[model samples]
Target: MHAANVPTASPLRTILLCFIVAILEGLDLQAVGVVAPAMAATFQLDSAALGWVFSAGLIGLLPGAVFGGWLADRFGRKKVLIGAVILFGLFSLLTAYSASYEQLLAARLFTGLGMGAALPILIALSSEVASVGLRNMAVSLTYCGVPLGGAIAALIGLFSVSGDWRFVFYVGGVAPLLIAVLLMLWLPDSRAYRDQGLPLRDTSQALMGQGRGFSTLLLWCSCFCTLTILYMLLNWLPTLLIERGVSHLDSSVIQVLFNIGGVLGTLLAGRLMDKGRALMAVVLAYLGMFAALAALGMVEQLQGLYMAGMLAGACAVGGQLILYALAPRIYPAKVRATGVGAAVAVGRLGSMSGPMLAGKLLAAGAGMSGLLLAVSPLVAIAALSAATLLGRDK
Candidate 1:
């Protein structure tokens, strides 16, 4: 279903192109976590150093999201997206070829910059191409690519190609390059974007104007809380599970199942949001996640843990997608990218902190259950923010 007011020839193509870009970014985002052990061994890294390696990518994401969004607003969405894809692709290739820990760290940071830049543009495209009523659905569908990408990366990690981690980066690097070429040939810049001819202006400040200051603050808080748990799980779950006496194979299986649940949850949440249930969906997802995380911490049986892991992924990762869907709705088209970018920039800080926080706690002898308990409050904070966010459309 399309929004009647917003007319376009074919929004489906736009949605698909943006979805593919998201998938590639997801692969790169999770690649470091998936191959962490191999990286540590090869580089002779300690846990603290490895934590920085994880943070390095996120650190790069901060500026990338802001600059990329501004660039899209100033230039055009398609051009920025194409450039972002190519940027990440080249850097990912560099990651594969890195000979030292320092080199890998540098490569990952640049790769992250590209990955971060691509996301806001994709979100903007997904929002601009859809009818108003379908905005959330379109965004959710596009963002599903993220969990899908993570699942693919997890699969590749499970059965390593050539038994080397570098091969993983090579696959991550090359696939995006091929996709960039397709994007160049086929992807449409949003019709609204092309038609407006709006002068380049600083729209970031407008997020706080329009009587939307509280809404902006709430959205940022929601993103921060949501991403903290999501990244904590994404980066450290496998290691935590293994530490809890689970087999390595089982841990990887659980992670894959988690991401698969995320894909399903995103799809489900989209339909719910289309029915004017976005806030309710987010609240329920976070509430369910709190339960799942608690259960996962206390449960010892493999079957039970697997089920909880899936539920946790469904709620946590899926809830994050809901925020992405909600973001474009909070601002006018002019500042849409800037607003979303600001929220993402805040979330990236949470993403950066999650792994590092877990690393510090784990190093301090906190067990898996303790770590889960530690982050449980974030779920509540996220739920509260969702319920209280102003200017929510139904």
Candidate 2:
């Protein structure tokens, strides 16, 4: 989005509109994992097969992020965002109405494509409107809607009738259509994007120009490693809990706790960054995730699992939110969306791999404890990368 006259619009409206989109996007994203059991029963899906189902949506995200960002830079954020929302909304409906396993996979893949595209724009739009100090907090507040939406998904599942898991998807599907209408009616085109001019810059130039290569690489690395574990937990926590003998209803409650925790953690992180303690926020997020991962594996009781779930949700999702906030500052307004989108696109690869890796290992009979513990090194790597990226001046 190139810059224009900065529109003279209230940032509150943009934040609220972006927040609503994040909520619906999140509901759709997290709905699948919550409904996994029902889909498993209906499709006779084994762990490995289920991994494929999870990855299918994520696979679409990679290209969606790249193209969506590219399109936004070329056209405009509002138009591309509207298109992306409609695409995902339509496919989410398909997911609800899917009658066969293949149909489900196809629907999820396309749904992911739309989601992937919309996310970068959300991050970009949220940041572009705020002052430097407020940008992180603003983005965090907006991004919290994702986990809030996840919590809503859990709630929908909790009250929904058995064998009618499609209800959650139905709600997720329709809400975006309605939100898209709201977006079209009230959401303003990004003023910051409008204020900037010249469309000659491309993704590579946006990311690598102005001596930004190393920091950009670190950002990608951090996002990739962090997102791998983040997504693994997001897509599999319910199933993993059940595998360890927790009841489905209990797992759903835990899922709700996880998402609620995410909302809290993300807000706290953004607040910390706005106060000039970004490095502190980074440390807390990664360390919390490390501890949470270990705890999830060792704790067997419902209370223990619930505690771990909240911790995981906070640290994992909050870590991602930090990256979303930081990515925009790395580039000028001319290519902010492209740079942020590229980083997110790289991170989506990690998201795609995390679920499949867990499923295959679990199918191969690896203990959950070992699997969770094995991720500690990855978390450490991400923490170091993120810290380095933070300390470096953009």
Candidate 3:
């Protein structure tokens, strides 16, 4: 085999490469929050308008994800990922120069296309390289970068609070460009892809056409609920804190803690999944998340709310890791990427709807307690879906 054909790196190096790509992918997903308030202020926009701007990227993600899976199956994961990074990065850089709200919206929509392509490919790459026993662990480790990237963006927001928000976008956009270059230099084509003799056409047909199963349905429902709850919290937490009388700075701090909890949760769940108990682990995480959110709704003090946020983040965000880890197992290798990509694409719809629904509730004067309570049932539904699916398998 040629060197490019050989998967010769240490497992640790493979993990690191996946993690870096994940960070880039995550930064693309999250960089919006760091500058959203600034965009609102600069554009003199209202909450509803801001919501649209945020949703636009997610809307764009739907098609981008579908196209990306086809490209990954056709060209290769490394190539698709590099192309995605470059596309998103260049658009992100151009966003800093937008002359009007329409221009900014257009830039974000274009950026979302790039963002959409990154995650599914990364998940496929990470899962393909991993040993069967350690597959979930590898996927979890790669996804840990999502929280890490969000945390980094929060830090940038703190420092750039007084400066032009455009600087934040510049940082978000450019860092990934460098990361893409590194990926091109350091990342290898997935050994699994070559070993399986998967040509582009075969993969594309599998993804775009009639491959369906009970497991695929179960995975899709699980991902939709998981992502809905995750995005709901991420989009609303800071504002929710402010509603409960927390200062902006303190709210930001809680947001950081929420993401920190996500990092810990991903690692913890990864270990559990590696031990072959992914379903049980996810159930426990969801239960914990339920309790945490309930506590958050009742808590009045900043400290109490912050602690609740941490617990919620740990459990809820970690639940998402479980979903991703379990996803790759639900489909055969022939349609793994397509299956995973389809789940993510469906999940994106929930993610996009989450914030808008939450915002509408808030606008109707539902308050933090009601908003938090609203998502609890969704988690329960997700836990039930997982149980039903996994139980049938047994």
List where candidate 1 sits over 4 angstroms from the true fold. 1-9, 390-392
Displacement of the residue 326 alpha carbon in candidate 3, Å: 1.2
Q: Is candidate 1 or candidate 3 better by TM-score?
A: 1
**Among these predicted structures, which one has the highest TM-score?**
1
Candidate 2 lDDT at 393 equals 55
Better of 1 and 2 by lDDT: 2
lDDT of 2: 0.87
Ranking by TM-score: 1, 2, 3
Ranking by lDDT: 2, 1, 3
Residue pairs in clash, model 1: none
Tens digit of per-residue lDDT, candidate 2, span 1-394: 2244333457888898899989998888878877887889988999778868877888889999998988888788999999999989999999988888899999999999999999999999999877877999999989999999989888877877556878877777888899899888777887766666655555686678778999899999999999889888877787788989999889888889999999999999999999989999999999999889988998877899999999999999999998888898888777778888899999999988887788777878777887897778889999999999988954
Using lDDT as the measure, which candidate wins? 2
Q: For model 1, what is the C-alpha lDDT against the true structure?
A: 0.85
Name the candidate, 2 or 3, with the larger lDDT value.
Answer: 2
Model 1 C-alpha lDDT per residue in residues 1-394, reported as the tens digit of each score: 1234343447888899889888888888888888888988988999889877887888889999988887887777878889999999999999989988889889989998998888988888998888877887899889989998999899888887557888878988898899999887787676656666773465756889877788899999999999989989888888788988999999999999999999988888888888887767877798889888898889989999999989988998788888888888788777777888888999998988787788888888888888888888888899888877723544
lDDT of 3 by residue, 307-384 (tens): 887887888778878777777666556556666777789888889878878888888988888887877788888888
**What TM-score does structure 1 among the candidates reach?**
0.94
Q: Count the backbone clashes (under 3 Å) in each candidate.
A: 0, 8, 0
Off by over 4 Å in 3: 1-7, 198-212, 392-394
